[model samples]
Target: MKNIFTIVLLFATLSFYGQDKKISFLDLVGNNIQVPRGCEAQSVYELQACNGTSIKWDYYSTDMLNEVFNATISAFAEGNSSKTEVTFTSFGGQLKGYKFKMGTTFQYFLMGTIKDQPLMINLGTPKDITKSDDLDGFLSLFFDEVG
Candidate 1:
């Protein structure tokens, strides 16, 4: 009888731990914001508050070729105004960033230091994309126009 009770208790504890966890980006926003598809949205506060062992933020933008071209006024521009793909990985207490270029221009760029990497975000046009490091911040600024 004692052995059976212990097995049952262990099973119950394991089952409870296996339940699915859901975290939505909308929960972090203070105002009404339409999060873009293929873009992972989360606030800095929410990220800090998370207790999960693994946390990540992935962002992407499409159908913005015209915007990219219009935003670029300099000759030294390297990125196109087409589709942008960005992925941010935060796992095991480390953050890494990667960017993928699509449409007319095809390329992949990695951000951060050679030894210790940081969050990687898509670099948009020359004028706007060049100045920002956090992709979420850039998206937040253009949320009104894009959303």
Candidate 2:
């Protein structure tokens, strides 16, 4: 009886741990831009590029989606001083970002709404920025949202 109980407990533990531990934010982008270096995954969903760039996927479950989007846009826009690249809204969804020329490298802050979810991606020469992505090709490999 004791042996059977132990086996049951072990099984239960493994079952619990076996649950898929993945959160996705990649549904936020449209397509993937092939970068030269490559990428390193910090977690199943989070990614780091070989070029000192890091990408973060943040998800908020709230009906007040616009509030979150506005807040994020305000935050990124407040600090930009170097230069502005382009700001536009289209099918890829609205995006506003900046690019800075640091010597020979290009630093950028690309933030916007991806699939109506708040999305922010930062990148540079793997030396300045901490986060980074591609849209279509990266989805299957990176963002697999498990219910």
Candidate 3:
């Protein structure tokens, strides 16, 4: 009976630790975005109000999709003093992100159509992504479009 109780406790602990560590934040446009847990929402007028130690985001919108995206990426790189090249990745379908290093940390500037409207988001993280799978996992949080 003690062994069975121990096994059950172990299983419960593992299950609790394996749970997803994320919280949802709705953008001004009503699109639900999943941010890392512990992000605190700031005051109005800030699209990227949700701020946390591990991750933060800034959201934008533009009428010209490609042109605006290119200019935004270039401006961000220049502003961050990042001389590195920007790497692009398609998050399946119309969703895509431009990964680059800003200062000492890595950032992903995502651009895609949300509800037929053009949307751009810059996801900033403090940790350096060393593995491809880790980067993928981070980017995957923004994969699904929800309201």
The TM-score of predicted model 1 comes to: 0.29
Candidate 3 C-alpha lDDT tens digits along 1-147 = 999999999999999999974335635345455444555444221224233223333345555666777887788667565444333333332546566675666676667655556666566666454444544543445443311
Off by over 4 Å in 3: 1-24, 28-37, 43-63, 79-93, 128-132, 135-140, 144-147
User: Across residues 14-128, which tens digit of lDDT does each residue of candidate 2 receive?
Assistant: 9999997543333335544343235555553356664444555554544444465456546655655556553433235555666565666655555556677665445454233
The stretch of ten residues in a row with the least summed lDDT in candidate 3 is 44-53
Clash pairs (backbone) in predicted model 3 = none
- Summarize candidate 1's per-residue lDDT along 26-127 as a digit string, tens digits: 422232334344444355322321221112222223234233323432222355454343332222222222323343332323232212322232333322
lDDT accuracy of residue 50 in candidate 2: 47
Instruction: Rank all candidate structures by their lDDT, best first, as comma-separated numbers.
Output: 3, 2, 1
Each model's lDDT = 0.33, 0.49, 0.52
Model 3 CA lDDT for position 33: 50
2 or 3, which is superior by TM-score? 3
